[model samples]
Target: MEKPNLFSIATKELSQDAFITWLLQWADDKYKKENEHLCLLGKEFAKSLIKLDKKLNAENIKIAKVTAGRQWKNIDIWAEINDDYALIIEDKTQTGQHDEQLKRYKKIAENYYKGERKVICIYIKTGNECNSSLQYIQDNGWYIFSRSNFLAALKAFNTKNNIVEDFTSYLDNIEKETNSYQSKDKLKTWLAAQGFYLWLEKQVTDWNEWNYVANPSGGFLGFWYYFTACKKTKGAEIYIQLENRFDSGIDLCIKIGADWERTTEHLYKVYGILFEEAKKFNIEITKPKRFKAGAYSTVALVKNAFTTTSDEKLDLEKFLTVLTNTENLVAEAALKC
Candidate 1:
């Protein structure tokens, strides 16, 4: 049996911030003699941050102090290193930056330093997030330190400390669980759905956005791509949406532009075009039972959209072919509209 992991119980962002802060504290010179392994790990982490800034070098630098929590304008982790660099880490676990917090935090750090100390901002996420979200973080000028990156760093330093071992084991378990969709016969958990969506984002092209779609009953992971302008209706567009509800089956939906009368009219015309085009690829797309007009209403749906293997697992290669065909079909139909 495996040992009990405290991280499993305390799965909050605050707990994760505390662990990281504790690890960074070992970088102080006072702990070098007592716990060299942890000290080296801490120093390595600091060096990783320093490496992000081209102007600063990690060699011969010592960590002066490390602070966590509400001390430095609510930044998750702040490390003052040797009168040259101040490292600001915004740690996240299963949540994303909101309300322009990344920008706000970066401005606060710069203001605090006032150009005296060079501020290096790092956004460390030890949880599953879509590629789009990660790109947004990068767009805001914060370097991303992802779960895989952190794991690689930890795996490099083999340690026997209980705290390190437990934390590492817990993280390893979480990674496995998040990636479980690849091995499972059926997708059942939200993590698995997220993993599937993230994988799809990497494979698919021309997608504008993807995220969770919340409903009163429950929510599902959704992806939108293949946006084509409607020649028939001005300021209107058509797009494809992939909605994965795990056990409920994947849905391939065609969303038409806003305006009830025009949308309703174009729905039938596009449906006819897509239905015939889909048939060429041995796929079937059906018009929705009832038509509801709105801003981007679902006009057609392909139920059980994913192609499965002989053993009933998701056949990713076959699914990719289906998606490619769908894109072509939609594009061809849009040309006629």
Candidate 2:
């Protein structure tokens, strides 16, 4: 008999009540057989991470690792993307890891930072234990993922299976299915079987991270090519972080004009260049319409709300001139330095 996935079990035809009992029995058998003290978990996880990359990217999004899988004490998969950056992924099967995992990675990533301001760490865990190990994994200020997450993972899986095919059909299915009582009962049973009932209530997700090194040009680079070439659709998100250190960053808003339309030869560039000459430069770069909490509105907000090119407005030009001049000076100084 073949192993049943969450969907097959949920949507499988069987009595609502007895099906739940059968599902748990199956999960217990499979969980015990495979997870036997989390055996072969590392290999399983490495395989899944490769799949996750393929599911996340919708376009020609690139992904790779700077390093290959070596049985390091605290790390697992190390890869890269776009030939421009790297992602260090560590997978654990059981509850979690010891406290010093991320601290240990310092020795590994210290070598890979070739003045490249881009990198990420991924953790694809079997269980949903989010504590210090994972927290510290992220606190080091690296991009991390424990798992693809439940909803996100499901959506990706469905897309791969060609279940609903498009967004409209997906939404329609959601509306039709979630409203009925039988569906809810089947779902509850499925959750209970997998030991995911309480976990679902708590909203658990999979993310996990760490670091290691061997040869950037050898196996590491080979794995990088493996991930980048096969998996094109990858999901990514970027955000800033501050932790009572009084560190400040600048804010700049942008509009996706040509990038979204995929037209024109010019690539719109947005990068931060801090000017030591002009302070009070800690502004968060964002799109024109998005107003962060506690931020005062600019004239651009009131009048040119719909327009993306708020750069053309008057007051914005003045304020931006000061910022650009500062950035230009900083760039010049850096070049000189």
The estimated TM-scores of all candidates read: 0.91, 0.30
In the range 100-175, model 2's lDDT, one tens digit per residue, is 6755664476555664734445554533343534566667644344333423433433222232223223333333
TM-score leader:
1
Q: Candidate 1, which ten residues in sequence have the lowest lDDT sum?
A: 62-71
C-alpha displacement of 298 in model 1, angstroms?
1.7
Rate residue 184 of model 2 by lDDT: 19
- Show model 2 residue runs off by greater than 4 Å: 1-74, 130-133, 142-144, 147-154, 157-337
* TM-score of candidate 2 on Cα atoms, chains taken together: 0.30
Go through the candidates in order and give the C-alpha RMSD of each one to the true structure: 2.3, 21.1
Query: What is the C-alpha lDDT profile of model 1 across 131-192, one tens digit per residue?
Result: 77888988988888878877876776876888877788888887787777664443667777
- lDDT against the true structure, per candidate, is 0.76, 0.31
Worst 10-residue lDDT window for candidate 2 reads 221-230
**Clash count, predicted structure 1:** 0
